[model samples]
Target: MSVIAVLALDGVPGPQLSAPGLAFATAARHHHPVAYEVRICAGPGFRSTGGPAPFGIDTPWGLEGLDDADTVLLPGHEGFRAVPPPGVVDALRGVVERGGRVGAVGTGTFTLAATGLLDGRRAATSRRHTRELARSYPRIDVDPEGSAVADGPFHSAAGVLGGVDLCLHLITQDHGEVVAIETERQLFLHLHAEAEDTGGTTSGAGPTSGAGREAAHSALADADREAAHGALAEAAYNAVTPPGSSLEPVTRWMEANLHRPLTLDDIAGRAGLGVRSLTRRFRAETGLTPLQYLLRTRLQSAQRLLERTDDPVERIAARTGLGTPANLRHHFQRSTGTSPTTYRTAFRAVVSGMTWPERPDGRP
Candidate 1:
């Protein structure tokens, strides 16, 4: 099993600390053999900054837990822009030095960057903070548009829901697609329903409908959430499509021919291989069958059109080969957790130099 140590610091956001645990636990619930052992560790004086109420939180482990961890996760906290607590940076550095993977969600990227491990590395943070992160850490290649980024063993995610994307990504890295997809279903459906029953909401909406589902989805339409979903989509694509893979030509062809109704035989013919052989090779190379990759590419293309142009959803869907507006909305919401209209609104606001309302947390 992979041992994951989550570093809880003073003023750490509660969701960031718990999302990974929930993801790993969901994986354990669905998988035959448990895949992860998650430990929440903290130095002394740890307190949660945002919750129903201000409260103290204590963990069973301390900084020492990181020493034996296979992965260490840092969740965004109130003090992200401030210097980290003593020993925090060193412990994070030690995890990477000892061959353990390290990742950050949202503003937690600021904490990881403080350790200097991100120097000369491409990292990501909340889109709103990208400029600040770039200015603060000149050595790090901060991707403002990235939802999640993985450079070797270092991973970073942007926004609040980004923790889910990050953890799901880590699960995907550790296990194959089948296990990760099952885990996601459990986490977003069963576990989310249970959470809603208790009058609580998960950081991101689950896949199923339940109490507060509409409200949660509404909340996810903000600028931060839109960025998070885009980043997640990008990260998922990157995870499957590595550099210089054999599937590159096929994928490029799919992108280029998205306006046409594509069939497996059509793809196979283009690749000069039998259908079965093409299917096997495509799955091996991209973790998805050719059809799945084509669908995702179509959705991504529609999203770009939504963001960049005033095209109607029907037109965008037809242009991306999705066939109809209703089909586009169905797949778009299922994949991105938001509607095309809502996504376009948020994206357009940013592009038009319009300022967003202050977040509930009061950050700009």
Candidate 2:
């Protein structure tokens, strides 16, 4: 198993402290996923100051814990606006020199920057801090739009919640999209599971009707839930919304019915518009014509299936409406520069890694 050492400084945000471990632990629960040992390594004065009632955190390890870590994560501290201690900076640089990776959350990027390792690398922090980070380290490219930014051995997140995004990205880099998406699926499942345990509340809506279902969908959307939420989420969403719901968006209908032989007229009819009007509206919103959007949706669905299943190419063809194996291969090759089989083979376990586990086939 790989060790993930979180170097917690004083006043580290509560969410940032826990999110990376939650993501890594969930990833370990999924099929053939990487096993990780997450350790909280803090200094003598370390404590939580980001919440209303601050509390001291006791851990078994210290900065020395970072020495054997596969990845060292730095969560933002109250004093991040100033320089980090020389010991901390030297320990971080040593990790990189030894070929391990380091990531920072929110203002914690400033702490990582102090080591001078991110001097010319692209990094991300919250939008409010982008200007400051750019001015402080002019050679670093500060991107505010990405959920997370990775440059060589360094990684950074935009906000507290973005620690989850950064950990997911690092998981993808160390493992593959297969494990990353599965990790996301587990996280979202946990949210819904919490909701269900609390009596299936739909925020005052009655437990039974179109109004209730609509509220549920809205909640999912608020959670940033997408098809990436995996099969359980898709099934639950479909159970509520279904096809032909008066309030259902046309694009959503397209997503649910990717297995169908849909056409321009089919899509336009869902939106109660003519094909021409549908084309214009879709182009304006998604930068793709209705048919073009459908095509992209089909290919996206195919990609997900390719990543998540053992179903053969012929069945994948029918499922994505690509029609036949040859047609699917042609489009897959055109879009991805590879065949579906080859794509799956490569995506399944890229291992492709900082002291990660050996391949399933037991290669070094």
Among all candidates shown, the one with the greatest TM-score: 2
Tens digits of per-residue lDDT for model 2, 1-364: 9999998888887787789888888776542325799999984367665666777777889999999899999888888888786589889999999999999888889999988999989998877889998999898999967457888999988764538878888888877664575466446535431211111111222122475445433432322222233323222211111123342488767777766666566778889998787766654444445555555456656766666567777777767766556656655554445566766665544312212343442211
Per-model CA lDDT versus the true structure: 0.68, 0.67
- Error at 216, model 2, angstroms: 32
List candidate 1 stretches off by more than 4 Å: 159-162, 191-364
Distance from true position, residue 100, model 1, in Å? 0.4
What is the RMSD, in Å, between candidate 2 and the native fold over all Cα? 18.6
User: Compared with the true structure, what per-residue lDDT tens digits does model 1 show for residues 6-116?
Assistant: 888877777777788888887765443345899999755685656656566666799999999999999887788988888998888888888889989888999889888
TM-score of 2: 0.55
Candidate number of the best lDDT = 1
